[model samples]
Target: MKLLTVLFIGLIMMGPSDPTFKVGEVAPDIALPNMNGEIVKLSSLRGQMVFIDFWASWCKPCRKENPQIVADYMKYKDEEFENGTGFTVYSISLDKKKEAWQKAISKDSLIWTTNVSDLMGWKNEAALRYKIGSLPMSYLIDGDGVIVAVNPRGDKLEKALKKNRKSESWFKSLFGY
Candidate 1:
């Protein structure tokens, strides 16, 4: 009886395991306000592949990567992905100041309409939900809302996007082609 009691105590002490970001897991949905004070939800982009970027206006690396993100969006926004006909980015900012966040979005020319932030900075609730430990982190989610890759940037980002392309005919095959 004492052995069983000790085992139970040890298990309790371990605490509940918090979910961490992973390639195959369903990326947690985010519902936060955009620069316009409107709420955006990640699940709303269900029919398209999405790149969920965790960034900050103060993070230089994230600022530097913004141009490439814009380029990739311009290049693939209309191209066919594995689960949809196009792609989009859902940028979640970790900025405590709304003005700074908006300025960065404008300055970077991140034209996506899905940018969101809680204005909590490093303590942003969405960041905590996703277990973000660093800036410039990203998750590539498929049309079905399952994460397919993480932090695919630069040439790697482009390659991953190209590799996931599913020809229209390929998609049609499952139905009739």
Candidate 2:
């Protein structure tokens, strides 16, 4: 009985643990310092479509993808969504230095969104909480806080946002907006 119990426990311990979260679930909240050093909470952006991106100043791929994300941001920021009213990005940088992060944001022209960081690099609180094992991790959540997409990039990012977009004439043709 003792040996059987030990084997069962061992198997249970070796089983895979859930990674942070997944699509369709409400995204876990993250509170960090914005560019202005103001504490911003992820939940505060409720009632809008939010893109939560985990990236870094030193990450080349993140830099490469910024322009596309910026373009998407501009395209959708003021637009209506099937699940939310407006769109915005909640960028979390995993940079150890403040200057490098700020510089990257400016150089990338990521000026239209809420860019934030704990300045802890890999040890960033949001990264750890989200179980971010790679650079440029991203999630798209709706107004209700439910995650709609994971790791969306480039046209895929824009596509995910657009797939659920409310048509320009949807309002005029429907009773509810």
Candidate 3:
């Protein structure tokens, strides 16, 4: 009976020990310094849909996707699609060198979006909190602070914007049109 009780307790403790951010979960807020030494906080952007992108200068895939994300941001800025939703991409860099991060942001033309980095490389607090084990991870959070998607690709991002636009239109039409 004693052995059984101990085993049961251990099993219960081991259940779901690895916490993964998932859909419907409230995104954990993060605060980090931007390239110009200005602090940015995730919670401060309440009521705005946000995309949190985690990347590093050394990751080739991240480098390739940077332009695509920038384009998506430009395409959706202040434009309400069918679903009455707008988005902002908040890029967080994991680069070890501050110059490298600033240079990459400028070269990639990621100027219109908010960019921040702790210059801690992989030891960034945000990365550790989000359990990021790889580069190019992203999270899509709704205005209410709930995570709607995770690790969405460029194509997926475009599709999501279009879908939201359509929904917004439908809502508008239902009321007056």
Candidate 4:
């Protein structure tokens, strides 16, 4: 009885571990196979901004956010915006079934982005390492591989991009116009 009480007390005292990456910290390199069976390494995209999105097919919020992500990607994928920043979205699905994952990707029209899944559900090693307690979480990584923001909403993302655009305009005005 005493040992059990002590064990319970110890467990209660221990707090949950923080996620693997944090804002301002360099994100760890990850190599995962995309939907096409192509392996993509995070380090290979060193000089571009990346959005590492953790989501699942069964997650309602993730589904709702898909369109917004698609729109943002479409807008920014073309050319280096005013701030000379190029964007890429790397979507990591937590689905355990291939059919559901593939179906969601098609339904949302998530084209031109890297989609990957281990089909391991919550047991996915990356998910566990990232300490994902919720779906639709994302990290904005800068060119240097440092995490710029975590779980930024659509509005916030737009605001950040807008600021970059404004800066670019100012640069153009000073130089050319």
Residue by residue across 83-146, what tens digits does model 2's lDDT show?
A: 7888999999999999999999989999765899989987999988887776667889999999
Give the best candidate by TM-score. Answer: 2
Sorted on lDDT, best first, the list reads 2, 1, 3, 4
Off by over 4 Å in 4: 1-20, 79-84, 164-177
Lowest lDDT block of 10, candidate 3: 10-19
Q: Output the number of the lDDT-best candidate.
A: 2
In model 3, which regions exceed 4 Å deviation?
A: 1-19, 81-85, 166-177
Give the per-residue lDDT of model 3 (tens digit) for 4-45.
977754543332334369878999999999877889998877
Which has the better lDDT: candidate 1, or candidate 4? 1
Please give the RMSD to the true structure for each candidate, in Å: 9.9, 9.0, 9.4, 7.3
Q: What is the C-alpha lDDT of each candidate?
A: 0.83, 0.83, 0.76, 0.74
Q: Deviation in angstroms for 18 in model 1?
A: 13
Error of 4 at 133 (Å): 1.4
Kindly indicate the candidate among 3 and 4 with the higher TM-score.
Answer: 3
The order by descending TM-score is 2, 1, 3, 4
Off by over 4 Å in 1: 1-19, 168-177
Query: Looking at candidate 4, what is the lDDT of residue 22?
Result: 76
Report the error of model 2 at residue 121, Å.
0.8
lDDT of 1 by residue, 1-177 (tens): 999977754543332243366778888888998888999999999989899988888877789888999999999999888777689999999888888999999999999999999898868888888776666778898898888877876677877787778864476676774
* Shift in Å, residue 18, candidate 4: 6.4
Global CA lDDT of candidate 2, please? 0.83
Residue 121 of model 1, lDDT score: 82
